[model samples]
Target: MGEATHGLIDGARHAFVSPGVHWLALLLLCSAYLQGAFDKLRDFGGAVAEMRRFGLAPAAPWAVAVIGLELAASGLILSGWHRWLGALMLAAFTVAANFMAGRFWTAPKAQRGPMTNTFFEHWGLAGGFMLVAWHDLGGHLGV
Candidate 1:
């Protein structure tokens, strides 16, 4: 590689392997859910409406459940208490929500690009959660 490219790669490697990087990464991963939880709490009515738009009936209850799960997952993962369980919860939630809300294949052609991007983005987040679970499990139960 060129000298500049090599330097950039080395810098990235350094950052990736830094001490406490795992903790930082986990925190960053949990940030989105944390923020969402706060937003739902702050604007509960809006959240319920959004859930209703997604065809989730009993919008109020579903909204509450979603916020509760987000909070629980954030707490567990951030506290490192049963982190694997938290990761799994978040991962499963992400997968389900992505498929439910991101239906790119069913969207109009003009909207497919953004919808597909969002769908894949959610999956990427799910993969991050899985990685967190695997790391936290430390090969326990074969992860």
Candidate 2:
């Protein structure tokens, strides 16, 4: 590569290896869960409605469970204590939720496309969590 291109690549490599990068990436991964938890807390009625729409019985209880899990798991991850366990918890949650909510095959034809995309995106998030778990187990948890 040209000298400037090589320097750019080197900088990026260094940047990615920094603790800041790890912290930022972990925050990004947990951002959705944190936001969801906050929003549910702010509008518990809406959360209950969402649970009901998803056919979960005792919608209020389900909403509370979801909020608690999201907050607890994401906190474990961000705090870097039992990070692997937190990561696995979120991974399992992501898979279960994808199955429960991303049933694209049953969706209307017009909506199936978006639903399918969401399904795969959730799977990707699960995979990211798995990788985070692996990284933590290896004792290289930068966070």
Candidate 3:
């Protein structure tokens, strides 16, 4: 390799290892993400029932599917298995969850009470996962 190319590679190696930032960031992200996944899993049945109660029975299957996807994605991310792909999937799910929460916030007052609280919690969890996805992507791209 040319001198400049060698230097560039060395710099990346240094960045990837010296500060230990990559692993630390991934650890934080994965930890937070896995926690959210577990939380959602614990309430998956409730989530489906809540959707049905809201007259979104047609979406119950979808809700279940999403929960499955989230669990799978969390597993992949935590294991660093095809990490880039996992991060992308997780990020997409995060965005979709945020959008889905908005619908709950606009429901009738009685329905909105619990949903409003859940929406905010989802919002925060999604934001944290997004950060994890971002950092994971950055590390994979060597940026």
Per-candidate TM equals 0.83, 0.89, 0.51
Best by TM-score: 2
Residue 131, model 1: lDDT of 85
Q: Candidates sorted by TM-score, descending order?
A: 2, 1, 3
lDDT of 3 by residue, 24-137 (tens): 766665565566557767887776776665456576686677667766776776677766667667767766765755677568888977777776776666666666667666
lDDT of 1 by residue, 5-111 (tens): 99999999898986588678788999999999999999999999989999999999999999999999988998889999999999999999998899999999999
TM-score of 3: 0.51
Backbone atom clashes (below 3 Å) for every candidate: 0, 0, 0
Give the per-residue lDDT digits (tens) of candidate 2, residues 1-143: 89999999999899788888888999999999999999999999999999998899999999999999999999999899999999999999999999999999999999999999999999999999999999898946465
Whole-model Cα lDDT of every candidate shown, in order: 0.93, 0.95, 0.68
Alpha-carbon runs more than 4 Å astray in model 3: 1-24, 31-33, 53-56, 103-143
Candidate 1 weakest lDDT stretch, 10 residues = 134-143
Residue 36 Cα positional deviation in candidate 1, in Å, after optimal superposition: 1.0
